[model samples]
Target: MPAQSWKLISHFWGLKAPHFESQFVIVASSFSSFLYLGACYGYFAKRERNKIGKIQS
Candidate 1:
């Protein structure tokens, strides 16, 4: 997953400079993935909390 995203990001920004682009892609891809994963986790976490609260009430 990470590797594929890295490749995708690199291929995107890497058009100008392949060497420098690798590092940028690494950071960008990891950050983007983390952000998305965090968002999904947060959404599900809230849903779970609501469900539990309703059940308990």
Candidate 2:
């Protein structure tokens, strides 16, 4: 939403400019999904480790 960000995105994409609303939504959704996936992975990995530890014990 900042002037510098718009310039960077336009330069990177080789476009005049990106639609602010659409880009914001896309970025927000992508970030949220990444966080969700990380959380899920961490939860499963911890559970698996605990299970293995129990088996070893």
Candidate 3:
């Protein structure tokens, strides 16, 4: 927040700066899940690609 904005808010309610520990955990978890899902998708897609257009004898 800008200095002026914080000063104005301070007149009524005090606003403290955010700590990064919890935010980092949330972000890390989100990225990890996304990467895991993407890897799973790629693995399955590659495995199915070879058989997708082939005729089964």
Candidate 4:
């Protein structure tokens, strides 16, 4: 995932050297998107597991 994002970021840099701010924004946004997804998955999984344990008990 990191490699893929780096590839995208590098590609943006290579193609748009003149638009430095835009490239940074793209990279930051892409990275944050991944981080948010990971956090969401973790929260959901933990909540589901807790529910299952309570039901089993």
In terms of lDDT, the best-performing candidate is 1
Candidate 1 lDDT at 11 equals: 76
Instruction: Give the range of the ten consecutive residues with the poorest summed lDDT in model 1.
Output: 1-10
lDDT of 3 by residue, 8-54 (tens): 54432323434554455445555666788889999999878857757
Please give the clash total of every predicted structure, in order: 0, 0, 0, 0
Order the candidate numbers by TM-score, best to worst.
Answer: 1, 2, 3, 4
Return the lDDT, model 2, position 35: 82
Please say which candidate is ahead in TM-score: 1 or 2. 1
Q: Residues 1-51, candidate 4: write the lDDT tens digits.
A: 456776677677758776776677667777787898889999999999999
Itemize residue pairs with steric clashes in candidate 2.
none
Best candidate according to TM-score: 1
Global local distance difference test of model 1: 0.80
Pairing residues by index, what is the TM-score of model 3?
Answer: 0.57
TM for candidate 1 is: 0.70
lDDT of each: 0.80, 0.69, 0.58, 0.79
TM-score of 4: 0.55
All candidates: TM-score: 0.70, 0.64, 0.57, 0.55
Q: How close is each model in CA RMSD to the real structure?
A: 3.0, 7.2, 11.3, 3.8
- lDDT score for candidate 4 against the true structure: 0.79
